[model samples]
Structures are given as C-alpha cells and as structure tokens.
Target: MSATKASKLYILDTNVLLHDPKCLYEFKEQDVTIPMTVLEELDDIKDRKKNVAQEARYAIRSIDSILSKATNSEQITKGVRIILPGKDRDIKLGCLSIFPDHELTVRTGFLPIEHNKDNKIINCALHLQSTFPHRQVVLVTKDINMRLKALGAGLKKVEDYRTDQLVSDVELLPEGHHYLDTPFWEGVDKVESYQRDGKAYHRVARTLLPNTFLNEYIYDSTQDFAARTVAIDQESVTLLDLGYQHLMNQSAWGIHPINIQQAFAMQSLLDPDLDFTIFLGSAGSGKTLIALACALEMVIEQGRYNKIIVTRSTPPVAEDIGFLPGTEEEKMTPWMSAISDNLEAMHEQDERPQSSVKYALEKANIQFKSLNFIRGRSIQNAVVLIDESQNLTPQQLKTIITRCGKGTKMVCLGNLAQIDSNYLTPLTSGLTYIAERFKDFEGSASVHFQGVFRSRLAEFAEENL
Candidate 1:
C-alpha cells in the first residue's frame, strides 16, 4: 500500500531494527517509516564482528532489497518506507534539541548512556517523534525509562511492544496429609489406573510406601489419588514434587513441568498470540531444559515451527575474544556449551549416545546464534529460545522480539538473581521488565519456580546462597 494510504505511520526506532532484523515486517500493511538517520546510524553497527553487527548488516541488506522491489510495486513489499523527515519532522527535533539527547530517550526502550550507540538510537527516536506530528506517531519500545522520558517530554502515546501478555498468577493452597490407616497399597501385581479430584494420575510400574506421619505423602497405584490432611507451607519440598508431577504429566503439550517455572514458560510458549515469553530461574532449575524440551516438542512433534533457534548472551565477565580466543567458534564454544549439554541429556542415552547431540549441532537444521549477532534476520516458522535473557538490556530484548515473523514462537529463559551485568539489578533487568510489562496479556504468562529440582546439593546451595 502507498505510505500515505496506510492508516497508521510507524517511525522505525534504531533499537527496534537492531533488536530484530526482520522488524521491518512487524507493522505489516501499515505505513512504516524508517528515518534516513536510523539507517545511517545502523551503518556504524552493521560492520562489527559480533552478532549484533552481523544482524544489523542482515537487516540493512534485507531492507535494501525490499526498497528496491517496492520501487516497482504499488504497495511496499516490506512494511518499511525510507523517508527523510521534512519541515514538519524537523520542528519536533527543534523543540527537543534543547535537552541533551541522553535526557530525551524513547520510553520502554533501551537507553544505555554508558554505550554511545544506544544514546544515538534514543536520540533518533526522539527526533522522529519531534519531526512527525500529523501522523499518529507512537514510540514503540521495550525500555520503560525511555518511554517515561518520551512522555515527560510532552510526547503522547508511547506504547510497549509487548504483543504478548502474561497470565495471572494462579493461587494455590496445599491441603491434605497422608493417613496411615488409609494407606492401602496392595502392591506389585499389575499396574492400575488412578483417579483423584476429577483428574487421572499416572500409574507407576512400581510403588513405594514409606512410613507415614500425619502430614506424610502417599499415592495409590490402583487409582491416581493422594492428598495431605492440612495446608503445607512453601518450605515443603516433598509437596512441590507431588504437585509438580501431577501438573506436568497431564499433557506433553502446553505447559509441562520440569520444575515450577516450566508451567510459566510453557504458558508463554503455547500462547502464540503473546509477543514474548520471559522465564527466569536459578541454574539447575530446569529453565533451559524445559525451554529446549518444549521447543523441541513444538517443532518436531507438534509441527509448530520449521526449526529451533537458540541463542544466549555472552557474560561480560568472560575474557574478550582478543584476549583468549583461537577461532570464532572456539571463542563461542564456552557460551554455547550449556545448550549442547542440554540437548545431549534430552536424547535417549543408550540408543543414540551423547555425541549424537553434538553431531546434530553441526547439522544446519537447527540454529545456534549469539545474542550480539541476531540483529537483522526475521525468524519465521521457528521456535526461538533465548537463554541468559537476564543479561539483555531492555532495548536488546525489544530488538529481539520485534524480529519475530509470522508463525514464530519465542521463549526467553534466564536467572534474574544470577545476573552478571554491572548496570542492572533484580527488578530492572530485561526479564523482569518483560514479566511486568507483559503480565496482563492473555497469550502470555510468567512463572517463578520456588524449589530447585536438579540435585540435592544444587538445591541446598541455591537456598543458602
């Protein structure tokens, strides 16, 4: 469609394209404008060795192709239209020019004053807002403070790009204690189906009935039935297992439990309507495992997507590539190893062997990308899993989510408490920002796993640490 004919005009923020290379198509059928300044700004990032730079380059090439094709087509093939803001656009910039560009930032997007690149992008957003008055200009961003700054500058209608919102926290209570007299485990002959409280429970091949106190737990093989006599406190680890298994085994699809957070992560993944899913949990808590598992099932078994794309933030604490690396893959090996390890564990141990997962890694069918490099490509018909999402800046998260293509699903998993960045805190981190911003959307949901499930020592250290 002609740029003027489209009802709404969306000015491309530099951070938007940087977050997702395919962000050009996000406003499909709408008049999407990319200020010449934004493209110029991206040129600086488009050449770096990192993934972010690579993505910027990809976006530049993709958008350039679109512009070339649109030169002949009546409607813009891509949603973006290149334009240098005219007299009206300059007026807004003139008004905001008095304040330092750092002070004038996009609300709900990244504004890393520490990073010069981010500062200019924020300025570009403000400049576009100032320049366009006639169009219903909205600053779409993932930075909360940027949004706040945009509004404080008297610019109206800043919006969070969280197309996905989270489901409300479910209120649950632990009730019932194991009864010694009623513990009728007539064992070991044949497995029988069990049903309780209107739900059918799994029938284990074997059953264990330890000595029971008034509050001890018990399950019957004959029927999937068990309950405690009183409300169990959150400190009850045994109860969480019972509760978690009951919920997880219900379906391989939707939300299956690896730990408490799996439910929340699953909710986010399944809600195709939600724009993003953010998962946070400590190490060994099954955050990555559950995310990978769910993504695998969705893509391979459920036919939800064409492939699985995995990426993670490189912790700043590590040695720089120049200082300790051999080749690019050698440098990235440490960061991607966790993902490789998880895949190995997920496969049938004896049938394929651990090396099979490594072989699969070499195959082109799956994608393993660095967070710094994901900038420019649109992810379509794929299940995108972002690990260590806590390290991403709000602007970074915004960029990543906006690149999602039609039929794509994204799952973000990270540990807020384990964040390694100097500039962020527990609540201000990107994962926290996503959880708060998108908590209300029907297609999105957030879950914080309370108990650790990896091992006894891991759980103990998490509690103590």
Candidate 2:
C-alpha cells in the first residue's frame, strides 16, 4: 500500500496483529496505536505451539525492535517515528504509538474490567477516538463483533487492515479459461496447427487470448470444442497437447477425468516440470480425489516423488470437534476422512490385486501430517497436498510453502467459497491469495475447476439447497 497524502489513525486489535504481524507497517503515512491490553494478550499467547503464537512473538519482536530506537518513554507512549521499508526507499515515516488502558466505569452493555479482553481493547479505542478529534480514528480489526461494538460506541470508522484483498466478489475471480467468444473458426486456416503424439496442437496470437497465463486452459465452444493450453508466450498460445490429455482418461489409481478441468488438473499434477499447482473448486469438485490419484501415480507407479505428505488446516469445515484420540495419524484420520473415502473409492474401482485403500496407501507411502509440525523441516522428494487450504492464514501458507525443498512438489487444493476461518473471506483466503500472487510465476500454475464431478447429488446440492 502507498502512503496516503492525508493522515489517519488506525488502532490495532490483537486479532489483527495475530493475523498479520507486519500490520503496523501497513498504515504507511498514517499513525498506528497498539493498546497495552493487546500487548498483554500477546505476551500470554507467545509461547503456544500454533501459528497464532508465532505471530504474537513476531509482533512483539517487531515492536521491541522499534522501541529500542526510541530514546524515551514519552516517545514510546506519545508516539515514535516508524520508517516503513519500501521498494527502493522508505515509503513514508510514520508514528507508532502505545496507549495504556486505564480503569474506568462500566458503560451500558459493556463487559467489566479484568474479565473481557474485547471490552478492554475497545475501551482503549474509545479513549483514542476521544483523543484524536481532528483526525480520523479508525479501529482496525478482523473481529466483526469488536468492530460492531466500536461502531455502536460512535467510532466514526472501522476497517479490516488487509488492503491486499484480490477480489471482493468470488465470481469476479477468473476461471483460468474463457470461451472463444469470437468466430475463431473463420480464421482457423490462419491459426497454426501441428500433430504431436497422435493429438493436435494449435497456436493462436496472444492478442486474441483472454488475459491468460502459462498452462491456462483455453476452449473453443463456438465450434468443435478442444481443451488444454500447454504453452504460453508473449505473442502466442499453444493448445491442448492431447499427449497428456489422453493420459487423463488413462487410470491413475482407477480414477479418470470426467471433464476438461479435471484433465487439466491431472495433467499439471502428473507433470514433472510443474512444481507448484492449485485446484480451486467447490465441494465434491473432485479436486482432492484427483490430487490423491496423481500423487499415487507419481509416487507409487512413476517413482517421481519419495512419498505423499497429505495435510490440511485443522479448522473444522462447519462442525465442532470435542477431542480426538490415538497417534497423530490416528487423530488426523477423522480430519482426513475425505481422503480416506477417495482412496477407498479409487481402490474399489481398481481390478489389481491388493487394491484396498489401506494397501494402496501403504504402497504409495502416504503420510498424514498437521501443518503445525512442518516448521523448520525441509520436505524433499515428496508431493505435498494441502487440502482445505482456504482455512490457512496467508502467513501460515507462506511458512508451509517455504518448507518445500528440491524435488518436492506442493499442490494446494481448496474452495474459495468454503473458507470457514474467521480471519478469511473469499477475497482474502490463503487459497485466493496464492492464486493471484503466483499467476505469472514460472513452473507454477493455478487451475480453477468449473465443474463438481463428485456425483449428480453433490452437484445438485452444491448448486441449490
């Protein structure tokens, strides 16, 4: 974000800092306030083993780094100069202020002191609002209820601190492909076509393309419809190398592509050159199923990856879990029930001996892991599948991705519409964040599935009630 010509005071909430530690620097030219209660909460959560705890430690360390440069307590409390690191230089030097919470009488409908962290945080915001009468005092938080209370308390402005949101409407996000939309068949003679591996490859000018990138699927619905976009250049695009598209119908653990999107996903998944790929779709979209099948093919059949490390954010989809038992894999089995179901379905369809899901997983050398235990580890020669990726925060996703070592491929699968975390929306979900961020990155491709091939019942339920 660029520095604003005008100034605004943004009060930080604990969740905001926990969600993103670098949020203090996001204000640019504006000032930021960190309430003492937020610091207290940070101190309490800094030692836990989860991502939030790590964020707390990071926020504290950042604050301490800035505070060490301040000469006096007055500067620390009143406000100290903070230089924001920019692309080439400092975007703008801003002030980082620390506000202490004071004992106060209970307002109507407010929680008491020493009991509610939310009330304490808002009380400090209330104090800041009164202090900054000349400037806008906006409470920045990821908590909807906290913002509502602050707004009810007559705070004129409150906003979500994340300004890097890609798309407000989920539908506005591109599907990685678009219909020909024009009479391309009339000019088909001019378009270059060649035969490769018993299938056809056609080339079209980039000007006629629909803002596509590497490996993005292109379709011609107007005439004889074809699929796949294997190569993209500055001036032209290459169409379906059915060499790989033909393999989509070939069995991968007894699974076949039901549509072109699945074929594209399977192609990317099985390709040795594509190191990173994403499959975005709704429930019963066959994303997880296809990823697992390809992982099995690469690891067990092709001997490409050492193993398959299947993982997902532990956040429940919609229900709640009281507790779980047994080993990490055992406890994680409930979370990975979808994976187990797909494996069983694939095994049942296979006619090979030892075709049970258990035998298939054993032969494939599959491992189930929680994202919590992945820190500081280099995962090499493995195909990692991060399911329910929408539940992960952006920072968490970055940490996981950075752990990928040489020969390791990571395929992130999630539905932007099924994000269940409080800190994320369709626009800001980690899945959506990576999809937009890696659009042009080499060896990385993002494919959005347009169909849910789980079953007619699932498709009907997804579309309707």
Candidate 3:
C-alpha cells in the first residue's frame, strides 16, 4: 500500500489518540499522518501522573509497533504499510506516515507556529492540504475549536473522529424500556402464558416489540402491568412477569423507589443474575442513591458480595491526587463525598445519624478506589459502583470493566448531560457506548431515570435550568 494510492489522507490530533489509543487501526484503507507536534505532545503527556498519561503511553506504543516495521527514514516519511490482525489479514489498507512539519520551509498560508500547539497542528494540516491537493486531505480532531480553526486556515476537510461514535444523536440511545399506551396484553393477539417454579412468564410474537433488547423493561401507561424481557428469539419474546406492585414495593436498605423509573433501576440493581447494569439520568435523579443503597443491601444484608468497590473518573487535570494528604480512600474522600451524602440520606431517620452512617460504611466493607489505580487487577466478589462514568472514553471504560472477576457485579452510573470531559459528548460518551453495545447481552441491563427526587428546588432547577 502507498500513500498516493490511498483514497484519503487523515491527519490525526493528539486528543483523538488519547480518546482511543487503538484508533490508528479504525481508519480502514485511509492513510494516516501524525504531525511531529502530536508526537511531541504525547511524549510530554506520557510521563505525567494523570489518567490520560496511561492512554498517552499506550498510543505511543501503538505508533511505535506500527512504524517499527519501516526499515528507513525515507520509508517512514513516505508511508509504512498497516497490517491488521486476524480476519482483516487479506484486506489491503493504506499506510501510516509521520509528517516532519517542523522541517517545512514554506510559511505562507500557514498559521504561525508560535501561537500555540493547536496552531502548529493546524499549520501541519494546512501544509498537507496544499501538498496533497488531489487527495481528500482531512484533519481529524475531537476539539470543536480546532476543527473551526483548521477550516479558517484553508483546510478543505475537517471532521470529528467518529469511528468509535455509535450514534450521532444521544436521544436515539436506548432508554432501557419501552412504553405502551395501551395494556401490554391488549396489543398482543396471541400470547402464551405459563408458570415455572412459582414465576410467571408470557411469550409473545417478537414483532410486537421488534426493537426491544434483552433485559429491557416493558410497561404500559395504565400502571397495572410491568415485565422484563429476559429472552428474545426470531419468532418470540420471553418476558418475566414482574408485577407492578412488586416493583413498586421493592426496597433496598430501607430505601423505597419513589418513581417507576427508580423502581426499574432498583430491580436491575438487586437482581442476582444481572452482572452488569447502567443508570443514566440527571443529577438528583436517585442514580447514586439507588446504586449505593443496593450495594449496601447486597454486601451487608444478603452477603451476595464480599465488599463494594467505588470509583469514578476525576477531572483530567486533577487526576494526579498524590499531592493530597492521606491514603487512597482518604485522598478520594473529596471526590467521593456524594457517596457519603447518600449514605447519610439513608440513615437520616436513625437516632444517631452520623454513627449509623459510620456503622453502615464499616459493615458494607466499602473501599473507595481510584480509577487511576484500577487498571490491571482482577476484582472479585464485589459490587463495583462507577460514578461519573460520562467523563470516561470507551477505552478507559473497557479498562475498568475488564477488571471484574468471578462473583462481581459492576454498576455504572452517569448523567450524560453533566459530562465534564472536554473530549467527550453525550453521543460519544462511554456510558452511551456500553449502554447501546450491551443492550443485547443477556446478563446486562440499563435504565434511564427521568424524575428528580433530590428536592423540590433541585427538581425545578433541573427542569428550568
């Protein structure tokens, strides 16, 4: 494969690589160019103590593994062939090249390199655009401002890296449930109802709910019926009949659900068979509260799990918490305050609320782990609660999720609307990615809560603001 033979040339930005280290292989047959400035940035970032430092190291290794195949500097600059693994072995792809933008003598029509690293990157893309006029040269970056600046600097094509993006709109993501205006049974003409081991199930034609996924809840507006889709086949759908009253009356650690959405979330969290669960909602929507409550019930009351592991994605700049005084959990206290607040809320009615909170914390054997330190460990016999998951990229999420071992159930809770990562949007968030990707997995479930139960003021603000 040659650079000129490739259909398009894509110049990748540093953030795109950090967002997904394996993204180099995602651009099928399109040739890729890495600016010298991007390599410099990655080198500077790889030694840092932040979470992104790990990704930077991975990206550098990936680039090296591919470029090491080249025998000479000329071949490296011209382009090196990219060979994919396994089934893609026979497919011919384009090349990977390192652009020496720093050596270019021409300064005309290029952004001043001294302005900032962004400008230096845009200048590299601009130079490529002018050199490869016949090729569809595109600058792929996650930064919105960078894309705009590249276009302003005469770059013909600019795009956000969308190879990992599963959906263009967040609203199209699954809400974990389907609503019916009429009674569920009323819509189905042929239904087979049966009982097994004191549990009821209804089998209906798959066409009735063609778009439903495994573990998705099905309920009607009448408030009299509710069931979870446990099995789906080409011809029929199997629903485990969970009575509406049963779901509404469910309690975990004495915390009863205030809404049907919360009821659905609690059901999934409490189910012994569900190993992976996701909760998507706004602040004050009971995501953290419900997850914590269930974690306590499962760990302390039922003994289903030995302990609870709580972790979350900290801000990129603040991920280096070594400067903070105390042990890992103590250093994480500031960020994990929401967990404490929920525990306090659960014990608010106790005679000694503070003491009760302390006792519950001790009894549950909860450990506050850092996302930075969670890599490369097999966590067993635990219910892992991942908060603020919207801030994570797909690769980061996969790193954490893969740590789960036998007898472990992981619950990821995130408010997509409140994502803090500049490199992430709701459509490209790991929360959305896993929610959609795991919808068909029989052991996983997802629920999106719509109500805000924190307080009246909080509810009003969430609605209006």
Instruction: For candidate 3, give the lDDT of residue 166.
Output: 83
**For residues 1-465, could you state the per-residue lDDT of candidate 3 as single tens digits?**
254667799999999999999998988888999989899999999998877889999999999988999999989899987777767455556789998877762545367666488888888887777777789888999999999898887888999988888887999989998889888888889999999978899999999999988999999988989999999999999999998889999999999999889999999999988999999999999999999999999999999999999999887668788989999999999889999999998889899999999988888888999988899899999999999999999988999999999999999999999988878888888998998899889999999999888899999999999
Residue 403 in model 1: lDDT: 81
For candidate 3, the 10 contiguous residues with the lowest summed lDDT are 104-113
Which candidate tops TM-score?
3
Q: For candidate 1, what is the TM-score? A: 0.49
Better of 2 and 3 by TM-score: 3
Estimate, for each residue in 18-64, the C-alpha lDDT of model 2 and write its tens digit: 77788777776777878888889899878755546677899999888
Model 1 alpha-carbon miss at residue 160, Å: 21
lDDT of all predictions: 0.56, 0.76, 0.90
Candidate 1 residue 249 C-alpha distance from true site, Å: 0.9
Question: Residue-pair clashes per candidate, as listed?
Answer: 36, 0, 0
**Which residue ranges in model 3 land beyond 4 Å of their true spot?**
1-3, 87-91, 105-109
Structural RMSD, model 3: 1.6
- Alpha carbon lDDT at 376, candidate 3: 85
